[model samples]
Target: MKNLGRVTPATALVLESLLSADSVWGLQIVKDTGKKPGTVYPILERLEAAGWVQGEWETSEERKGPRRRYYRLLADARPLARDFVRAQRSKASSAVRPTPAFNEGGWSAV
Candidate 1:
């Protein structure tokens, strides 16, 4: 797989969603991540371009709506995707801080 470059929070969310299943439809990922379609689609495209993901159009005619594109992480890239997701989660958790309480003078961490 090629370098994925900067992995944004949206991209991390997408990766997390993908890791949860063997294959996932793009819309399902959008719903799973609660991210906009605009945000999720591009990330999927980028992942596919980077060789980390493979997307295939649904061939079954039994389904109703528009043909859904199912995406799956390349076998060799799964471990790296997991590592990226873990790192992103670590950063996100570390970056979060409790809301500051208002003190008599000003705001305080306590």
Candidate 2:
């Protein structure tokens, strides 16, 4: 499997959602993570490109909506997904702090 270079917070959220699901379509993931299509699609493409996930188009004849692309995490990548989530969580926890408000003149450190 290709190693992922950087896992952004948004990407982490997408990956986290996949962990609980057997397989999911693009829009379902967007709803599950509350991420916009613009954000989620690119992340899905990245994951598919990295070989961590596989995607296929649904071919059922009874489908009612637009053909959905289903994405699934490769069996071998689940451990990596777990590790990535843990790392992202640790990184997020460490970076959590109150944001400094802007002053009248310009942006302030406080």
Top-scoring candidate (TM-score): 1
Reference-based lDDT, each prediction: 0.94, 0.90
TM-score for candidate 2: 0.82
Tens digit per residue, CA lDDT, model 2, 6-109: 88888888999889788998899999899999999999998999998999999997979789899999999899898888999999998887777888898765
The prediction achieving the highest lDDT against the true structure is 1
Backbone clash count for every predicted candidate, in the order shown: 0, 0
What TM-score against the true fold does each predicted structure earn?
A: 0.88, 0.82
Per-residue alpha-carbon lDDT of model 1 for 38-106, expressed as tens digits? 999999999999999999999999989899999998899889889999999999999998889998999
- Pairs that collide in candidate 2 are none
Q: Can you tell me which runs of candidate 2 are displaced by over 4 Å? A: 97-110
lDDT of 1 at 85: 94
